[model samples]
Target: MKLEMLDTSIFIAYVVGLLIIALWISRNEKAEGRNTEDYFLASKSLPWWAIGASLIASNISAEQIIGMSGSGYALGLAIASYEWMAAITLIIVGKYLLPIFLKNGIFTMPQYLEQRFDSRVKTTLALFWIAVYIFVNLTAVLWLGGLAIQTVAGVDWMFGMIFLAVFSIAYSLYGGLKAVAYTDILQVVLLVFGGLLLSYLALVEVSDGQGFIAGFSVLTHELPGHFDMILSPDNENYMNLPGISVLVGGLWVMNISYWGFNQYIIQRALAAKDLKEAQKGIAFAAYLKLLMPVIVVLPGIAAVILYPQLTSPDQAYPSMMELMPVGIKGLVFAALVAAIVSSLASMTNSISTIFTMDIYRPLQPNKSQNHYVHIGRIATLVALGLALITAQPLLGQFDQAFQYIQEFTGVFTPGITVIFLMGMFWKRTTSQGALSAAIGSAIFSFALKFTFPDLPFMDRIGLVFLLCLALTVVVSILTASKEGDESSNQSVSLDEVSFATDRGFNLAAIGCVIILTFFYVTWW
Candidate 1:
């Protein structure tokens, strides 16, 4: 399974192309009157297309391109559930969540929390989210991207990790959200194209005797348990996690938290020019989510047929690239770099936003914009430095990178999701309640990870979410004001906004429900 040494030409092309895009966007970031709002929020004037591309690009990090593809290679098509179910989640967020945030003209999710709850609650959530955004999501992005480059190009993942970390910091350091969003359009296109090309080629290679449908048919039939919906904990399969219920449940909660509440991902939609563009952007990302499995997952599935004896599952992507023609290999490698930078820029901008607005401003008020933006640039470089160091160990343990990240996310997502939902919609939700819920949820997840790691992990997300919800309710009720104690300084009423999706979403939902049902029943 060993492949050729890294393709230097392709690697150089990818890195150079990304730098050009970032530099190109950098020119417009500091225009007169652009200020922080324009830089961070795209002047609140992004169209649906840009927002949509940014959303998908930021979401489809190297983790999904490499990790999810590896999951498909090992676990089969059922793993596509993660990408597909996300479509439904996006629709929910678009139909209900977008209007609330857009109508209020909020900047960060934590800013919304502050307006809805209190400063303490807002600051706590913002700080926690920034940590998770960097140490968690940002780390995973750099780790996976570096691993991919190392496998394909022998560039020393340590150096690749630094390259990604520094590149992300550079533009996000200078341009902020405008830079992040504009470059994301190019990244999104590259990711989709590179992935689709690889998958189509893999299918074509295998289907030489048979057609596309026939090749997959041969694979599904000849491969035992190829379509199995349920995997046993005791099964010797390398891909199976400890618990089925937990895996399914954990993934569902994680995706919801990411798509629905995460500030970094949702910031693009918030920057949309209007409600219509926001709605369109989110819904379009939803459609792209549905297509992700075809672009990403299917290739992993096809890889099993091409190189079945590889010791490391993560190598599936790199191995596939080796089989590609020389020029295409260079382009695909560039695409991988694009995917990595998109995530890096996104995380850097978000971390800067939370720190500057939520932390620096409140503690050190009356600072000049130049002074703060300077700090933001400094913070960007610092965050990138941290992210690079975090990925150092993961560079060698590519096999465990995906699992390690999931375990880390399992610790934070449940409670974070609950507090966000409550803060957004419930007028009764109190600052005390929000803080208490976060603390309780964190403690509960830590206990699970350390004390009872053998139990179902996904199932725990539901328990944690419910516990936070109940705790929030009790604390809020006890501290509930008779008058106006619940209102934050930025409160507004948007209970009557209407956001009707096209009939197409309904039809797609119906179609997906039926197809997923058939998949589960037949595979199980």
Candidate 2:
């Protein structure tokens, strides 16, 4: 399904224009002299809209576009629980978590950990995140993105991967977070437009040009099983979604770990102009999450009917793109590229941040801010290089990269979630306890995996989270009693930090919930 000349021209124009915008945004940073704060946090000036756009841009990359669409082809709409559930999770994070982070003025998650616990915990998790971002996250994004281009435009996969990596670094390397966040607005718009366009075309084809609504009706009427919001135990895809547990169990812990504590995702909110704007951005992202399934998932479901002979589920999205006309195909292809590179930029930026702020800066305390910023840039390059080298080797075997990523990350999310949840709300939690939970998370998850092979991964994560939470509490109590320091070791003053939101935010949250309820109820 090679793209036509017009399509190629449109995609090239988009790429060139995006690079210009990014370079322009970052043009003044070097002249003004770079600093860690300016480069890493965008000088703390992101408004709600940029922050919101960047959040979605950074999140819905190759995994959501290609991988989850593959899951949609295989697992049905049950896969959409990840996006739909994340809408509610974003609200919870905005209301409960962003306030604390804003009040603390922390640059990185590890820095927050250091404030609440100690350097040991900060360094440990910082190292862990760097490794995961480079190996698991960065590689997966690059691999799936390269695969997307190969499938859609008949481009060489290696060429596509290198182009994405180079393009991301070219736009983002100098301008830093500012370049990434602002350009992300364009990226999100393109991705949404492209995604919706693809979905609409797919539906129209499904209805034999009867139109989107008619096509949607035909799909729901014909493939009723694909419309199920909650998969029953007997459903083959139940292991991935795990039915009602997606709403009530381990998925919540997963969502909290991702939306709340993840460095790249939360970094956007942390860069907001103020707490109010950050919360607003978060609320804005929640609505976007509600829209994501329509853009990313529907095309895959349509693929089931349109191109049932696809060799792999991941091919669903690209296969659908073949249905687009010339110029539209270019625009949507550019949108897919936008989603991929934005995330690559975002992830690399955070990797640099965690490395520079949490690890390197601490060791070289007397280094100039410029030197730290330089180190951060270097770290970004290094991380991306590692990912490029390892992307294929790491993710080549996975048929559904989205589910593989979820399962791989699920093992560690429980501990990370427990540490953050207990650290923020429970003053009694000690550094040792947090560290124990972090380490025990992997041990418990692996043990459960081998011992109870039949248990759904989602349920396993939920149980492991509870176990980690209990471990943190018990270890905190015992350690405190042994040390004869019963009072809280947490340095942050939570009493002074307010979690209250403006009325607009409250209304937006209610709207998000209402929309999600409508989706689930209608689908269920």
Candidate 3:
């Protein structure tokens, strides 16, 4: 599937134009010299739209587009619970979590932990995150993205990886998060438009030139099982998306940890001008999440009828792109690249932030702000270099790298979630308790998995989360000082933080819930 010259030209122009715009957006900071705030937090000045767009752009990477599409082909719409549930999660974060983070005026998630708990808890999680980001996350994105480029554009996989790495660094290393966030608006716009166009064309094929509604009708009638929002216990894919557990079980723990506590994802909200602006941006992102399935998942469902002979489910998305015209193919390819590079830039920026602010700055606390910013840029380059060197060796051998990554991360997510939730709301939560939860997450997760070989992973995560929570509570109670000093400086001052939302935000939350309910009711 060699790209026509016109398609190749469109892709090249998109790449060049994005580089120009990203550099241009950050030119003032480059000329004037960036401080730690400017380089890492975007100078605390992101508007609602940029925050919203950047959040989605940074989130929907090659792994998601390709992986979720694969799930759509294999497990059907039940996999969409991840995205749809995340919309509600964003709203909860905005209403409850963002107020605490913004009130503290912190730079990173680890910084917040340090404020709420102790240095031991903060440093432990910080190191864990940095290691995972560099080894697991960065490598997976580059490898999966490279494979995607090879499939869609007929490029060599090695070249595709290098190109993505170089492109991400070119625009982002100099200007940092400000560059990444501002440029992400364009990336997200292209992603939405190109994805929607591809989906529309796919549906048209299913309808044999009939319109979208008719095509949708044909699909519903022919593939009724594919439309199930919740799987039955007897279904073969039940382990992947357990029947009712997605709504009430470990999935909530996973979503809260990712949306509320993850550095790369939450950095967008942290950079906003105020809590209200951040809340608005979060609400905006919630709506975009609601639309993601149509773009990323529907094409795979349509592919069941369009390309039945695909050797692997992951091939469904790129296989469907064969329906596009030449010019349209270029636009779609550019959109795919947009998703990849945006996520790369966002991840690298966050890695630099955690290292520079949480780890390096504490060790070298006397350094000037400019010096710290310089260190951040260097850290970004170093992390990207490491990922590039190790991408293939780390991920190339795995037939299901994305699933493996999720399972590995799941081991730690429950403990992490317990730490954050308890630290935020429970004044009795001690530093020792928090630290125990961090270590116990992995221990409890693995212990349960081996003990109950037949237990569904989602149910295991839910059970592990409960065990971690109990461990934290019991430890905190036993370790509390007689004079109350144990919980004194370590707890968030909830009285000083306000969780009140404006009328518009309340309305948006209601709308999101209503829409999600309609989706489940219709599909079920």
Candidate 4:
């Protein structure tokens, strides 16, 4: 996958073009009178298209491009359940979750917690999120991005890491969420087009240039094992994909935690002009999710057909790139870089937003909005710096970066999700009950990981979530007041109206479900 001189020049030009666009957009923000809302929430002015693009762009980072491809090489199309299930999750979040957050008019997820519970609950989870974003999410993106560039271009991994961090900060640090959201439109376009081109070229190579349909037929006929959408229990990777459990078990926990509650992903929907625009944006993103496995996952299966002798499954994507023609190689490489940088920018913006809105503002209340904006920019610099320093070492511990990320994050998501779901929908969940659930879930996750070493990570997450829910219920009943409960004042009322459905959203959601069902039934 080494680049020729012309290819190298194209790649360099693509990088420079992104910087130019970012700076041009940054100039739109006025120097003075820039408030916290302008910097953190894009002044709440993003349209549906931008929100949809930004959501997909932010989500499909090096993890999906590199790690999930690796998983595809090892686990087959079964791995695509993550992406397809996410489409369903996005619809659910739009129909059931967004109304609650939007109605409260909160900028951060922690703010919603404060409204529903107490400041202590908000502060505890906010700190937890900041730690995970810095140590896990941010660091993993940089490390995987660096590894991909090194594999394709022969650049040093550290150099790739720094380049990505600096490029993200250049636009997003100053212009804030607006800069990140607008530039993502270009990022998503390049990502989809470039990824599709790569997949098409690979299929053509596999069929010896007969055509896409012939190539696809050749692919499925020769490597029929690679098309399986479900894994049998006897299969070694069963715990990871586990046949029907992917539909009924902990995969739901993972998808809901990510699409419904994660700060970076939800921030785009939150920043939309209004509830209708946000719902529309989410539906648009849902459709895009249905197409992701074709672009991101199929190439790895193609590599299995074409380059079976390669030792590491992680090399699947890089090996596919080596098959591309000179000019197209660079274009595809640019798309890879675009995916990495867009995710980094989205994460950097979210880290700053959470820190300023949830952490810094509460410590020193009633400051000028401009002053808070200044603090946010500084927080972005610090977060990026921390990620650059820590990414490589953190990633070095894992053979498969994707699974490592999933297993580690799985430890926390179950507990966090329980607290949020109960707080949003139930009237009796006390602050003490929420706090106890949060703390106890972390302890139980770690204990389970060590105590029962053979338990699947997905099972661990489901089990932890149930335990947390039970604990919250018991603790709430014991601690509830005889007089009017104190927590009732802060409780969110979830009546039938709050989960109302519309024609457009309902149609789109049903379409996504039908398409996913068809894929599973035909492929299984």
Computed on alpha carbons, the lDDT of every model, listed in order, comes to 0.75, 0.92, 0.90, 0.87
Best by lDDT: 2
Cα displacement (angstroms), candidate 2, residue 56, comes to: 0.2
Clashing pairs in 2: none
On residues 1-524, what C-alpha lDDT tens digit does candidate 4 reach at each position?
A: 57888888988898888778777777767754488888788889899999999999999999888888989888778899999999999999999899988877889999899888878989999999989899898998899888888889989889989988988887678888888999999999999999999899888998898987788898789878778888777877887777777888888988999999999999998898988899999999999999999998899889888899977777788779988788888988999989998999899889889999999999999898888988988988999899889897888767678888888888888878888898888888888888989888889999998998777788788888888999999988888783246655444776533677679989999999999999999998
For candidate 3, what is the TM-score? 0.98
Query: What digit string (tens of lDDT, one per residue) describes model 1 on residues 263-376?
Result: 889999989988877777877787788778877777777788888997877777777887677677777777787888888888888888888888888888898877777777
Instruction: Looking at model 3, report the run of 10 residues with the lowest lDDT sum.
Output: 482-491
Question: Per-residue error at 52 for model 3, in Å?
Answer: 0.6
Error of 3 at 423 (Å): 0.5
What TM-score against the true fold does each predicted structure earn?
A: 0.90, 0.98, 0.98, 0.97
- Consecutive 10-residue window with the lowest summed lDDT within model 1: 238-247
| Candidate 4: Cα lDDT at 249 | 80
Shift in Å, residue 398, candidate 2? 1.0
